[model samples]
Target chain A: MPANTLTDMILGFSVIIGILFLYILSLTLRFKQEKRKASLKNRRNIA
Target chain B: MINKPKLLTVFDILTALTLLGALALILFWTPVEITMGPVQKVFYFHVSAAWAGMLAFVAAGAAGAGYLITRKLHWDWVSLSAVEVGLVFGLIAILSGMIWAQPIWNTWWVWEPRLTTTAIMELIYLAYFILRSSLETPEKRARLSAVFAIISVITVPLTFFSIRLFRTIHPVVIAPGGGDSAFSMTPCMLRAFLISLGVFTILLVDLFWHRYRLAKLNYKNQTGEN
Candidate 1:
């Protein structure tokens, strides 16, 4: 085998992993933000 | 704070372990192709992502139909979450497919039926979001988006069969009658491919669950209901 396509394989895997990581990060951040807002809203209603 | 389910946590660990196992099998177990060399390894994840995306779209369509039949808000959430997650997997498949194509096809993209239909399917789902955003009321938004989701999913089967239906350079690995696939898979290669598909399926469910929770929270927040 020539094995010359190492670069392309690396690029493909990097892009797949990178996109998944970024998406998970976005989901986590949004979940936290939403939770905080909901809590604050509950507190205000109680007050 | 909403308590995380114990089963979800267990599923998270399972997905992570299976994904790591799949990667190790691809890197160390599968033999390198004499012609395509290392880049052939990309085939495992590339195909897996595309399969997962297709499954997600199917689920979304089913959920849409369920919403229409029952008029339940949970079905609406499931439909939206599946589409959203499906978009991510679709993007991965397209980008990875492009990378693989550049080396094999000597071009970044071609107007082949498979490629063209996949792009169109992605666009249709993208429009699904735009349609949802345009509506103000929850009832109207869910109803309209559910209809759109159901109709748009007709493209999923079209996209899947495009290579078989048309003359194209894209490889069809699992086609009937041993269609025009560029390469044949050995036992080890087949094992790795199956493992990758399984891992992606698990990941899809995990992400869909998370996204559904987010959608539920957003719905509750918007309507100020529990």
Candidate 2:
């Protein structure tokens, strides 16, 4: 419970949260990319 | 548009709740180690994340086997999704372990078997992505990646056991002194540990599902684009 080791705690949580955030961001990016592809396909069909 | 599964939505909420609960428990509820102190708390999640990441690698191998035998796109997607998730979580495990090690071991890294094997495994899986990206055809990409997945998985157990056996000689501090102490767990710590595992597993499933869906969509679009 020493104050010194608190840095590791912060670093650990930062890793956990940072990885989650990166995955979520990745999901959003992929979703958008897929959406664009789908929409473009639809426009081509309409044409 | 595909309907989001009701169960997965429920899982997302459950995952969030349990993970938050586990974090609170670790940060507030558990007794600080008398010697190692607060930083030791990271050990729980570090070990759990490493375990789950290993499991994900195994899942990728299974997916790869199914794909090779059945030649199903779904199986390929599963393998690919697992690889991606495994990479993310694996990196987390390594980083967290290193962070914990810096203080306890007085070294940021060691040339020990466990760390070395894990690093090698990460590189192998990372190369899977690079290989997939280089290919233009979906069928060839899937086939090649599947083969790589299965081959790469064989290294995981080798990595684990190699580390275990090597640890016996070096007698690292992190290694539990004996079988009984290794198995020993207080009820509170057990609860917190299990809860964290459950949350991480749920989170993995959710991410895999979402990634697979995106892959499916991408595949469909690619076919249509052709």
Candidate 3:
């Protein structure tokens, strides 16, 4: 049981950590986009 | 119009700190199970994912109710975001369970109550997205999706109870006399498990807040352009 599962452990850990990294990347991209949009709106108001 | 609030930035830092702490606790501090050995480490994250998945589903249901009462598009966005995130977490839970099971259960798939019910719940969540995608009008999509979200949540409790019942009838098949899904944890293991749950919940809240803010900004942009 334990012998065959080494790969499963690696796969499971990878998936969990990979998903976390993906979510963090997504958040960062979203923050940038929102900031740009806000700035654009501000410039529009000034013009 | 506004940046992420100060509280959210603080949450981002807290989330990072807690997640790193959880990893350290699980990888170094926790004891391995006698029966399951190293693979048992997956249990902490599996259970945590399940918790966050259910929490997201409940949030979707609540937001659906709010939309119905208020008839606000923002509530619809909240409901949609909750369901989307729930689907992602729920998929992780199911796949992680299957991966863990293959080592212990000698099979990649099981008709066990909990496993089966979770699979079914994931399906219902997938259907929610499909239902939303099929609609063209935003107002109609919001109303129909809200209705679907409310109606779909009814199956969650039923799925849970049915699985509990399924477990009762089947003789313990996989692990031992009690059941196939049993795991015995030492104090360190238990602490690691609890810590993982806390970290996952915090991560879920942080993501939800960000998703909601993005949706709100998109809405404001649309309204302003119009």
Candidate 4:
């Protein structure tokens, strides 16, 4: 029988997916933040 | 304000679905290696991520060339976006590789040639950001950053051939006679591996496009705002 590395496999996938998730989240947040800043600048200029 | 393209939305959905399908196939369809067991499965996406990361750097280098010839910030956006997305994929490859090594190598880290070269390559690209932020103007930043990216790309091929050049415990998956670190793959395993590579490449393109758009927006905001 091969050595059981099931825990390591799980950990590997989790880390891979977790990193992707976090990066995607950060990308989305940056877009929203940029949009908000644009809106605020527009409002100031109108005033 | 730029609106998101409908085609990009469709492409994003397809990429996500393909990624899920690829993961499921890897987990369920590929047979476990009798020697290494389940953890051998990590090799599929692990190597694929590394491939995507390298491809990104190459794209960045090509974009750098485009910037130098045309002097367009659009190419700069491509270069910057590729490096950013490349770093993420490179980090994923390194971390996933460490996990795989833990069980196979009986350690979390090693000073082996392949591993060391990879870490160095990642660090070289990471410095691209620091170099960009130090410049006083956008044109200066883009011009210098393009040169840095073009020069730093040497590390990619160096990292790639490290295992072939020197003795290392790292697996030589693509090398012939794959001594020591090589494992023979069954047909099913090969199919899954190819699918994973395709999926990751698509993911890399999607991420680069999104990032390029973000770079454009960031540039617009920095320059257009009073």
lDDT of 2 by residue, B1-226 (tens): 4456788789778777877888888999987766666887887787777777888899999999999899988898899989888888888889988887888788888888878888999999999999999999988998999999999997789766775666532223234565421434567877777877887887788888888888788888878843
Clash count in backbone of candidate 2: 0
Q: Which residue window of length 10 is worst by lDDT in model 1 chain A?
A: A1-10
lDDT of 1 by residue, B74-169 (tens): 999999999999999999999999999998889999999999999999999999999999999988898998999899889999999998888998
Q: What is the Å distance of residue B61 in model 4 from its true position?
A: 1.0
- What's the count of clashing pairs in each model shown? 0, 0, 0, 0
DockQ for candidate 4, please give it. 0.78
Position B28, candidate 1: lDDT: 90
DockQ for every prediction shown = 0.79, 0.62, 0.49, 0.78
Calculate each model's fnat, 2 decimals: 0.73, 0.57, 0.43, 0.67
Which portions of model 2 show Cα errors greater than 4 Å? A1-3, B1-3, B168-177, B180-184
After best superposition, candidate 2 residue B165: deviation in angstroms? 1.4
iRMSD in angstroms, per model: 1.1, 1.9, 2.4, 0.9
Candidate 3 runs further than 4 Å off: A1-4, A30-47, B168-182
- Write the residue-wise lDDT of candidate 3 on B33-54 in tens digits: 6667777778788888888988
- Residue-by-residue lDDT tens digits, candidate 4, B76-143: 99999999999999999999999999999999999999999999999999999999988979888889
Clashing residue pairs in candidate 1 (N, C-alpha, C atoms within 3 angstroms)? none
For residues A1-47, what per-residue lDDT tens digits would candidate 2 score against the true structure?
A: 35478888788888878888888898879788788878888898999
Error of 2 at B112 (Å): 0.8
